[model samples]
Target chain A: MYGGGYIHDDQKKKPEMQAEDPVLLAEFEARIARGEKIEPRDWMPADYRRQLIRMIEQHAHSEIIGALPEGTWITRAPGFRRKLALMAKVQDEVGHAQLLYSAAETLGKSREDMINDLINGKSKYSNVFNYPAKTWADVAVIGFLIDAAAIVNQVANSKGSYGPYCRALERICYEESFHLKQGHSVFVYLATGTPTQRAMVQDALNRWWQPIMHFFGPSDKMSQHTETLMRWKVKMASNDDMRQQFLSMYVPKIWEIGLTLPDPNLKKNPETNQWEFTEPDWNEFYEVIKGNGPCNAERLAVRRASEERGAWVRAALKRADQHYVTPLA
Target chain B: MNIQSLDPRITRLGIDAEEKNPDQTLQREEHWETYQVFHQKKRGEKHSSVGVVHAPNAEMALLFAKEQYARRGETVNLWIVNTRDVLAMNYDDYDVFSTTPEKMYRDPAGYKVNDKIAAYKKAQLDV
Candidate 1:
């Protein structure tokens, strides 16, 4: 249910474009251009496979890690009904991670490798999860706004060129509609409740504003790398475009509920038809991404412990005759 | 330096905030092999391939599949097959079926006897 608009690529060294067989490369490009999906066994350029693996793997990690903050609230949800709904939402988030991991697996990275990379601090998830959900209102804001932002990203990605990823996203998006509705219900209730409740939601909104702004990552530098990824349908929309789409879709909803965003500068430019606001501190965003955020250590530690503690049960279930096989999509 | 989490449950775990564990890696098959899942929306409907789940056995795979695929949907039944069991043709070999559509003799739409019968009826009327 949680994803960001940006995916990170290692910047230390640009990938050396190996001279692929021109014939195969053209056919691959043509297939993409014709809007045909690239399947698991199809011939593709090495760069295309590498980029997709990275993007989908990061997305998978985001869904799993994103569950932790909201998961903290399940035991303390305001009522029995809210508790049930929150539990369902958390379970769906985990299920989404599994689906995404499987999608990335079709590109040849195993789920184990992806999990190891996550817990060992070798990969990144959605940066927004690094911040803590300080109150029940925080959960509402996340479910309502964060999920809204993610839907914008996921909807675009469902139309991407990879068959397995697209199929998984199609199903994921369908389930996400419920997440959005439930989230909005909670959000509206809190916003329109007693003065204390209203203030709590407003305070949560102020704290979460920056992270939401940073959710899509910084404005992308239109580079040659980005152009190629777009042509390949790997990068579906620019980060800024998604951020604008999020603001346009959700800001009025927030205002209509009498909640104010932290930014006084937030407005739509009449001429350009774009959202303008004080840019979120990109320095802080990068720092959090570098594993320095408030919840970064706690998230990884919990994840690591889960894997370690579950080892015995996994071992007990293992059959001596078992052999690993790549899944067919 | 224990993590003083706002969530009392996390705080109760008493995890060291500064503890840096060695690199954790899972061995191959640690999560076990994958099973492809087929889900039927309702009775009498054919089960269609949904996705895969990694588990230790078919029973666990099916359990995982229900949690993953049938979470919010109408489902009467589910089937789990080991990924190893299903044989599939490679996409590279897809061209083998490329010319099948052009074989008009095998197509029902290729038949034109109605037009010939109509022409014969018209000619008989003219005579």
Candidate 2:
């Protein structure tokens, strides 16, 4: 059992000497142990660099696209304060994407290339973002629960092996604190408001609950990537462990607000010191990841429309550069 | 001196010296090249660089910067400058400062204040 209190039932393999030059591997491991951040110009394994680029770029894309769902409700917010909060939250997501993309660029990928990949649908973002934010309550639930789930994962990533990613997460985590509070406040208001407001809140919670559970990824047993991720210290915690942390922290909060979680089977077990919850439909999770979610088509279409609309702005900049000339005598 | 009606003259050096080129006459339109964003969190604080945004003009740049950077209610003042207009020291000219020894005297630790503090503490105890 680890200090986090989860026993590793899986067998541990003996640490084999890396097949690469022994001296270099020793140096790499020594740096990691010393808590020294690996900068862009520093030497790293090709696989390490590739993995960081892929992960960071996808995270950036998610933030950029993730703005769309909640951005739809900014105008419809019931009060001036709510509207301002929604706008600020969406704007923060955009800023976060810029910071993340800048970090990914440290890995040698160009912003243009990553943006192209996202536009052409060659890249994947967090699957939770594909679902539509149908109502103002949905926005509240997303901020409260979806953002909360993201905060849990991001808090772990703040300790990521990549230095820039960790640094960027510092700012991101601070902003997310405000977001989580705003979300919780909105949900509380609705939960305590008129029957219609309470019903809307409940409906949003029901729709978002399963997706939140699935946000931690598939179970540890099925995660083939976990072993390598752990070996490299890229992912310090297992998927199941992160999921358990989310449930334990959040399930009670949901109940405290006088709302029921969608999973009737969910309860804390005294013996196991763990929450027993109905397993989310993994098939649906996979389906969403594969672009079969309810709002996948609509989300992609909206992104494409925005990109197309902004084409003129890019073209105008390019043309403006052509007009520059040195003053002549 | 008729300006537009002046006869074109070729200089002895064989250059077109007299003809004013219409291409040169029309001043190039200057577009907003870049914006430097500053954020002030409170009323009395100095604004600091949050980041920069590229735009077509100052007005557009300010709008974009507000939307992109200050949407979080974090800015009270913003300054936008054309990227080309900002004069910066060239790295090629940076060799002038290379001859000086590393300035250790400017560091607070270089003063060795710990000994002074200890001596003062001992005097007070003696008193």
- Best candidate per TM-score, number? 1
* Model 2 / residue A46 / CA error / Å: 1.2
Q: For candidate 1, write residues A77-110 as lDDT tens digits.
A: 9999999999999899999999999999988999
Clashing pairs in 2: B32-B56
Q: After the best TM-score superposition of candidate 1, give how far the Cα of residue A79 lies from its true spot, in angstroms.
A: 0.7
Per-model lDDT: 0.91, 0.69
Off by over 4 Å in 2: A1-22, A222-225, A319-329, B1-127
- In model 1 chain A, the worst 10-residue window by lDDT is A8-17
Instruction: Evaluate every candidate with DockQ and list the scores.
Output: 0.76, 0.04
Tens-digit lDDT string for candidate 2 (A1-329): 00111112213442332356667767776777787767665667766776677778878877887887777777668999998888888888988887776677667765656766676666778878778777889988988888887888888877867787787787788888899999999999999999999999999999988878778776776355556655566676777888788888887888997998788899889999888888989899778766798766555555554555566665565544533211110
Position B103, candidate 1: lDDT? 94
Docking class of 1: medium
